[model samples]
Target: MRVAVTMSAEHEDARYPYDFLRHNYIVYLQNLGFVPVLVPNGIQNPEDYLTSLGVEGLVLTGGGDVDPARYGQENTASNEISPMRDETEFRLMQCAVDRHFPVLAICRGMQFMNVFFGGSLIQDIPTQVNAALDHRTGTHSIHVLDSRIEQALGIRVWDVNTYHHQGVHTTTVAPGLDIFATTEDNIVEGILHPAYPIIGVQWHPERPSPSPEIDLQLIRSFLDKAFWK
Candidate 1:
């Protein structure tokens, strides 16, 4: 299957900007039998570009934080906000929602999905939430609350690698989406749209995992959903 994946934009020498994707993302997708198509951040018409590529699915890769202004908030806690990437992904998401396209959003991509669906983020977990777990580093346990995710991975509780400060909470979850998994501190870890082939996780599945089998199974489940005529 062909999948459209978003790339992160970074400034080189403060003069030139370039796009990059983690090699793990490409290797993981290829191992799962997916033909990955890299999508640049500076595209003028991302929705049209997706259509042009004839991709069957979309993968929103992790990178810089989504600008808070997009969610009607000020630039309080966000870092390395990429306006071009945000604009492109939002357009791609609009096309995905309209077409009921399959999407796998990871880390920052997951937070972006929440904002795209009329949801809010905590911005900075440490300062905003009391007694929050150390989300910037190390691995944490997340309790699977939905049967779909549980059945897909064959485990209820799993320790996932964490590297994000922003998070989604139960109260801030979107209307059409359901919280599928969360950490012990009540931080939202997974979300899925019941009506669409869209799933967002606060952890990076492409990165090295303690349980590699579970990660593979998750990607397999997404690929199965992405299969269409």
Candidate 2:
């Protein structure tokens, strides 16, 4: 299986070049018997061309925050905006969804997925939610939502690291969306399409003691769907 891992651009001589990506994501995909394709940021025709090139899955890596403008919000100085990466990833998400490509979106990647689907986000989760749990800390517990995300993870409780300032905040969320995981304070930590084989998690599953089985299984789950066509 060929998995196109989206890269976050690094500024070098004023050019968005492929210099950044959580190496664990690449190594994990390779270790799982899949070819790793680095899809750089700021590609104009990311969707049709990459899809045509036989990209079976997409791994949206963590990066700077999505420009609020992408989701109808004003860009704040506080936001680490990367318009180029946002454009590339959003387009990639659309293409993957259109082609039924399995995707693993972590942190910022997850936030963009929600925004891409017309769901709103809490611009600053810490200031807005006022939840008891510290979301920026490391290795916290999460409650799994049964019959949706749990079935996929094959576990109920997960001690995951929290490292995001933004989160999903939609009262009237998109239809057929399933809540797969949540923080102790009831924050959405995971999302899954009701019928599609797509799942988005807010935590970086490829970090710390990475879950080879879970990560590969998730990608393979998508490969199982994207292939055989």
Candidate 3:
């Protein structure tokens, strides 16, 4: 199956901005029989562009934080805001919603999905949430609350590597989305839209883990959804 994967915009040099995506994402997808196409930010009419690509599914990769202004909040703790990437992804998401395309969102991608669906985020977990788990690094246990994900993954309780500062909570999740998994501290770790083929996880399944099969299983489940539906 062909999948459109979003890339992160970087401005290391003021005169030479560029877009990049982790190569592992491509390898992971290819290994699972997917033709991974990297979608650059700042495209003209992104929805039309995605339609032209003839992709069956969309993959929102992890990157910089979503702009707080998107959710009617002032920039308090969020960093690396990419307005162009945000615009592109939002348009792509609209197209996905319109076409009922399956999506697998990771980390920042997950947070973006929340904000796209009229949800909010906890700008910074450590400063905002008291006694929060060290979400910046290390592995943490997540309780899978949804049977669909549990059945797809074949395990309910599993440790996933963490790599983000921003997150979502129960009170801040989008209306139509369900909190499928969460950490012990109650920080929202996974979300899914019941009416759509959309699954968002706060962790990066593209990265290596102690049990690599878990990540493979997760990707397999996403591919199965994307291919069969």
If both were scored by lDDT, which would come out higher, candidate 1 or candidate 2?
Answer: 1
Q: Number of clashes in model 1?
A: 0
- Residue 219, candidate 2: C-alpha displacement in angstroms: 5.7
lDDT of 1: 0.86
Per-residue CA lDDT of model 2 for 1-229, tens digit only, reads 7878877766534453454777788776777787888887776688766866788888777766777787787754336576788888888888888887778777777777777877767777667776546777666777776553456557687577768777775352445666777877667787767665667778876777334466455456545553222
lDDT of each residue in 62-91, candidate 1, tens digit only: 988888888889988888788889999998
> Candidate 1: deviation at residue 192, Å?
0.4
TM-score of each: 0.94, 0.83, 0.94
- In model 2, the worst 10-residue window by lDDT is 220-229
Q: Which candidate order results from sorting by lDDT in descending order?
A: 3, 1, 2
lDDT of 3 by residue, 1-229 (tens): 7889999888644578999998999988888788998888988887777777789889999989899999999999988889889999998898899999889899999999999999999999999988899999989999989877887777999889899999998889988898889998889998888778888989988797755788677767765673233
Using lDDT as the measure, name the better of candidate 1 and candidate 3.
Answer: 3
What's the count of clashing pairs in each model shown? 0, 0, 0
- Quote the positional error of residue 170 for candidate 2 in Å: 6.0
Candidate whose lDDT is highest: 3
